[model samples]
Target: MASSMVAVGLALAAAGFAGRYAMQALKQVEPQMKQALKSFPKTAFGGGFYRGGFEPKMTKREASLVLGLSPTANKVKIREAHRKLMILNHPDRGKTHPDRGGSPYIAAKINEAKDLMDGQK
Candidate 1:
């Protein structure tokens, strides 16, 4: 009984020491973690495209990017790009399983990009 009690006491002391060491280690790392986080950009990842809240009007540059076209692309190229994107991403294309395929939001964005691109010319 005394040997078991000694073993238990030693185990408890070792655990307490380990926990204290871990807490000290964390405290030392806390300032470095804060500094690293502070150095990061305020915007979300993907170059800030996934920002929260309401979206602004699509710019010409953004339209071109959506359609995978050059900013200086002509009307014919723009039309072709729009057609290709619609064929691939149109929500209606996912007839078999509505939720599993194309996204309505993406389709809407593609259409909006086409309209914006057309109007800017």
Candidate 2:
């Protein structure tokens, strides 16, 4: 019991010393942090768009826009939008394809857009 009490007292003293040191360190850092924050862009911690193949490649707004549908669109509307967009963007539609010789890239993007939008279904 005596040993335990000594250990507890040592722990409390160590903790108090550590806390005091941390408070002093924070006070030293506070002005520099304030200055850095003042120079930081307003977009910090917000309005971040995911990129570089990370995750969440398509936000709801982006998927909807790609499919030419509203964000609140139903499956039927999404399907219709995807179909209409695909008709114009399909790569092998051949002559009179609007793109004339439609590119595979556009078709892939259209298909991806459809898939993203239809994911909810």
Candidate 3:
């Protein structure tokens, strides 16, 4: 009987130590995860951008491609393209209609296309 009691006590002690160690490890890792998330790029066009490398510079042709527009599309065409893409790509719209799989990257691309169009004006 005494041996069984001792064994139970040791098991409890081991479990307590393991739980404390796990809590400590979790506390150490949480901040690292948050920092990593915070350091993620603000704009990632279709998961194309990465860190510590050459940033891809989009030309008017590339921007048009992202917006699903023809290269010869005019300002009004670009605006319509941006509006249509934004309706499908905005994060909020995706959240509200989770079935459609809207992409924040597409929304950013739309914004980029609009900026390019404005710059040409």
Candidate 4:
């Protein structure tokens, strides 16, 4: 019937108007959102205030802990610890290895700790 067609046409016009209104509202909000973000503290996002030294420097003590060595461990002990840990957590050793889970990140940290220990000698 003509009445049904009119109803469909009205519904379509209402949907189009709603869509246009929503787009305008979003446009109005966009600038305000950007301004709010700019006014916010950089540290809140872990980028602005903490850029340079936010991360603690890897210390000899921390390196020894990573390698499971005593603070007074010598070069030989450091090397031994490094090798043992690498054998267990080297990225090449897939995580499916029995009783061990190797990760690329862990392997990198292990290498870094070994290098730090070596540098002290």
Candidate 5:
């Protein structure tokens, strides 16, 4: 009877270990499956638009307005406009003045404008 009990106990331990290993394997596979799903191309048939390889389009007018400069403005004027706009739209100042709503977007737009204008020169 003691031998039978030992056998049963060993069997139970082995089963428990197998179960734990199976669970871990499943856990690892779940993430890989999720990653594969995410990497899959979005399809219109799946009720999703293709977001892959798409970039935001910017226009010269939008850039000039963002930097607080006229569209006809030159490189030197663009730089000056960006400087002035940055002073008002800086995120640090927005932190102190909660009404400004943390002007990071404006700051980014200003930087984009400067980059576009500088590129044109």
Candidate 6:
């Protein structure tokens, strides 16, 4: 297996398609990643390396529903909901509190939902 991977690597390097192949592999692994990478500008906003953007696909309504908030929910309500949900679902909390098994994806989704809602307001 090691030798096969080394040979593949050498072949890709010789073909001068290593970076492109790697990026293509990344695209396959993460279907949603292509949009973010495709939108990159030549330079970053703060005059640094342009780290790619992370635009979540969840719409405002979807995000609000995920957080159990109404579409018209204000920032305070959103903030409170996010805090409560994070505490209840956080991974660290799982170790300390078994009843609440840590859910990293839920936490991340909650954050994305908040971001989507926040941007609208």
Task: Name the candidate that leads on lDDT.
Answer: 1
The top-ranked prediction according to TM-score is: 1
Q: Which clashing pairs does model 2 show?
A: none
**What's the TM-score of every candidate structure?**
0.51, 0.46, 0.46, 0.47, 0.46, 0.48
**Residue-by-residue lDDT tens digits, candidate 5, 1-121:** 9999999999999999999999999998998899988997653335353344313765776675556556788888988888888888888885755997437876886787788877852
Q: Write the per-residue lDDT of candidate 2 for residues 9-99, one digit (tens) a residue.
A: 9999999999999999999999999998788664312435434441246676667656656777888988887788778767777665555
List ranges where model 3 is wrong by over 4 Å. 1-55
In candidate 6 the C-alpha lDDT for residue 61 amounts to 65
Report the alpha-carbon TM-score of model 3 versus the true structure: 0.46
RMSD to the true structure for each prediction, in A, is 7.7, 17.7, 11.3, 11.2, 14.4, 13.8
Candidate 6, 32-116: lDDT as tens digits: 6667776765432233533443346777767766677787888899899889888887778768667768777877888888887
Model 6 spans > 4 angstroms off: 1-56, 96-99
Query: How accurate locally is residue 20 in candidate 2, as Cα lDDT from 0 to 100?
Result: 100
Relative to the true structure, candidate 1 reaches a TM of 0.51
Candidate 3 on 3-23: residue-level lDDT in tens?
A: 999999999999999999999
Give candidate 5's TM-score: 0.46
lDDT of 6: 0.75
Model 1 Cα shift for residue 44 (angstroms)? 19
> Which residue segments of model 1 deviate by more than 4 Å?
1-55
Off by over 4 Å in 4: 1-55, 95-101
Candidate 3 residue-wise lDDT at 43: 43
